[model samples]
Target: MAKNDGKVIAQNKKANHDYFIEETFEAGLVLQGTEIKSIRAGRVNLKDSFATIRQGEAYINNMHISPYEQGNRFNHEPTRARKLLLHRKQIDKLIGESKQAGYSIVPLKVYIKNGFAKVLIGLGKGKKKYDKREDLKQKQAKRDMDRAIKDR
Candidate 1:
């Protein structure tokens, strides 16, 4: 029998539009029971979400995990900082890279791998207004090409 992989609860498309991702890494999330239940129900959002290396560890911020309907006072906070599990070497690399000029780490996507929740974090740099315009133009051009080919 095939094992069940934890499904992708949500993704942050805005993160890609606002930043030019340089690299990406996957990290495990430390989630509670209710939070996992909520995620399985498709009650999660990654919009406006980001990650930061604080003190000596990394944490995800601004991610909204809707409170479990069945959970009363045991519900987790929707916007609380969630710890990200990464190796020491990886954390060090992230910290150094983040301190470099114009570099940041943002949560790109969240999905289940095996039975654990995993987050795809990107090392990114903020995009200028002109860069965004250029990206938009490129996307439009690609779409037009696809349409022309389909019509042929």
Candidate 2:
């Protein structure tokens, strides 16, 4: 297996806007043959995907890995629940944090690290309406500042 080299395939941009990420963990994905092919083709979506600890294992829900085009008979399902490989200690930590109020395990991005498929999962707390507005305001301010600097 190759080590993680930070080649991102798909990312959920809304994950940062919707939650305040407290911590992130890199977990390996257990993908079927066609699934990995689809991922390499950049036909994957992390939007609306989340991870859950079930029976002491981590599984990602709603992750969409499009079926390989050339594989007719053996195509994998697009949105099947996929298992995430993590250490026992990490799984236990995720379970504890996810059980807390307003906290969740959300998939942030999917990337090829080494030769394997990996998912970057975040332990996040949901943002309030006000929090979202505040973020927007800050972003706008930063953009305005950059523009002003450029025009100077």
Candidate 3:
């Protein structure tokens, strides 16, 4: 069983465009029954979701997992702060790095690994306007080069 063999549930594409990810960590999620069902059904949104280290623990905020239609009164909230299960050392390291200027803990993606829901979190630095522009320019240049090569 190779890593990354599990199905990807959702991704935060905006995180890549808005932040320069310095380091990434995989953390388990503390999910409810309905939340797990919704995630398994691919009804998760990583957009605008971010992770924060609080009181020596990690919690993800703004993560939206749609309620299971059949859940009825047992349905979980669409957007709720969820706990992230991580080692104490990892949490401490994340806390130390996050306290630095312009650094943040952002949720990059979510997936099901070995029947367990997991999240990929990143230690990121916010990108400036010029940084984003430069990235776009470089991407365009790479695309043009690839097109030229394919045309030959």
Candidate 4:
């Protein structure tokens, strides 16, 4: 129906606090049977997950997908380097940008779109301590303003 319309499975909230995202791209995940079942069961974690381009392909590392409860010995590993399905142009752009100083590819969020798992990856640069502080201050100020308005 709408862009990115699906049930969100997991999110890496720390990525925003530690980096300033420059751009975002949606890529589909190449998951196994048990992995998909685990994801649909809400047994996935995006914490500390990141994206990387290698050999003209993209992969997501450190993502955890708990084994399906009913799965037998064929269960997938909890954390694995899974392939990411991205366009060649997109991968090339990500590769070029990631080669720059202080740039990284981070997984922002994961969701199921049209019965397929998709990950939202972001190109981000590390935020300086002062930048993070400023962001905190701005957020606090916005909250204060909203509270004041509500009281009026």
Residue 137 of model 2 has an lDDT of 100
**Root-mean-square deviation of candidate 4:** 1.8
Q: Weakest 10 consecutive residues, lDDT, candidate 4?
A: 1-10
Among all windows of ten consecutive residues in candidate 2, which has the lowest summed lDDT? 1-10
Q: State in Å the error of residue 113, model 1.
A: 1.1
* Higher-ranked by TM-score: 1 or 2: 2
After superposition, which runs of candidate 2 have C-alpha atoms over 4 Å from their true positions?
1-4
Q: Per-residue lDDT of 30-85 in model 2, one digit per residue for the tens? A: 98888898999999998888888888999999998888989989788899999999
Deviating ranges (above 4 Å) for candidate 4: none
C-alpha TM-scores of all predictions: 0.93, 0.96, 0.96, 0.96
**lDDT agreement of model 1 with the native:** 0.87
Candidate 1 off by > 4 Å: 1-6
lDDT for residue 23 in candidate 1, whole number 0-100: 80
lDDT of each: 0.87, 0.90, 0.90, 0.90
lDDT of 1 by residue, 1-152 (tens): 11224576788898888999888888899997699888878888998888998899999999999999999897899999999998898899899899988888988878877767888888999999999999999999999999999999
Off by over 4 Å in 3: 1-3
